[model samples]
Target: MTRTVLVTGGTSGIGRAIAARFAADHAEVFISGRHRDTVEKGAKEIGAHGVVCDATDSQQVAALADRLGKVDVLVNAAGGLPEAGPGGRSALDGLLAQWHASLAQNLLTAVLTTASVQAKLANGSSVISIGSIGAERRGGSYGAAKAALAAWNASLSAEFAPKGVSCNVISAGYIAGTNFFRGQMSEERHGALVEETHNKRPGTVDDIAETAYFLASPGARHITGQTIHVNGGAFTTR
Candidate 1:
């Protein structure tokens, strides 16, 4: 059966790769991006449908849900380090802006998107939210938001798992080939991250894509409400 899969932030980075993975399997994939042209372009490249949606906005998210029939898999991949505005009137103002941006982009996007489409999720479906290792480390505001994402998933799973729906968070780390760093990643920083990994290499988008694919598979039905770390040993759980 062709799965009806939806991926937010599918224009680039990890989200794009996940969408492509599903599309390659002939799944009925739909990708959502905040920009129209970017969504169209990404959809064309991945052979999937595209919707213009800023996941942080409830109205747009509602419209997106209305457009879908049944969603077999919902990947809440809309999030990143939001760029701070030009200036802040005061120190407190800047802090507020940064924290708000972090929460809205990293946390609220997933919450709003999932809630809006909650009814559309089919039985035996999956809800996978993209998370970060920052939540377990020096993530600051962004990390705090991601940690909350996992906490929310726990409750979400308990509510949905009884109906054959699985919820999970994929906590990724040091993934390369994406604009995640916003062009601020220095070579020294990159090397330091890679050195900490067991494999001595940075993660690829495909790594997380494959993990997402597996978690949605039948083998992963018993793996709900868990945070699957894909950091290549950069962050290990004892």
Candidate 2:
């Protein structure tokens, strides 16, 4: 059966990889981005449908839901560090801007998008939210938002488990080949990240994408409300 899948923030990076993964498997895939051109281009390149939507906007999210029927898989991949805090203002104002931006982008994006399409989720569906290693360390505002994401997933899974839906968060660490750092990552920082991993290599988008595929598979049916870390031993549980 061809499952209908939706991947937000799919224009590039991890979301793009996820969309391509499902599309390659002959799934009915749809990807969304805040920009029309990027969304269309990404959909074409990945052989999936594209929709222009800023997940942060309620009206746009609602319209997106109206465009689709029941979705068998929902990947909330829309999230990242915010650009440019309220600079030149008071330090408090800057801090507040960063916090608000972090929450809106990293946490609220997932929350709003999920709530808008909660009714459209098919039975036995899988909802996967992208998280970050920052949550486990000193990620500041961004990290805090991701931590909240994991917390929210626990509750969301409990609510959806009875309906045969599985909800989980993937806490990724130091993934490469994405504009995640927005060109701000220095070579020293990049090297530091790689060295922190036991494997001495940065994580790839495919690493996360494959895990997501497995979570949506029958093998992972029993997995829910868990934060699966894919950081190459950068962070581990005892």
Instruction: Encode model 1's per-residue lDDT on 23-127: one tens digit a residue.
Output: 999999999999999999999999999999998889999999999999999999999987876673698888888899999999899999899889888778999
lDDT of 2 by residue, 1-238 (tens): 8999999998999999989999999999999999999998999999999999999899999999899998889999998988886457998888888899899989988998888889988778999999999999989999999999999999999999999999999999999889999898999999999999999999999999999999999999999999999999999877
Off by over 4 Å in 2: 86-88
lDDT of each: 0.94, 0.93
Q: List the residue pairs that clash in candidate 2.
A: none
Model 1 residue pairs with clashes: none
What are the models' TM-scores? 0.98, 0.97
Lowest summed lDDT window (length 10), candidate 1: 82-91
Superposition TM-score, candidate 2 onto the true structure? 0.97
* lDDT of model 1, residue 164: 91
Runs off by more than 4 Å, candidate 1: none
Candidate 1 versus the native: TM-score? 0.98
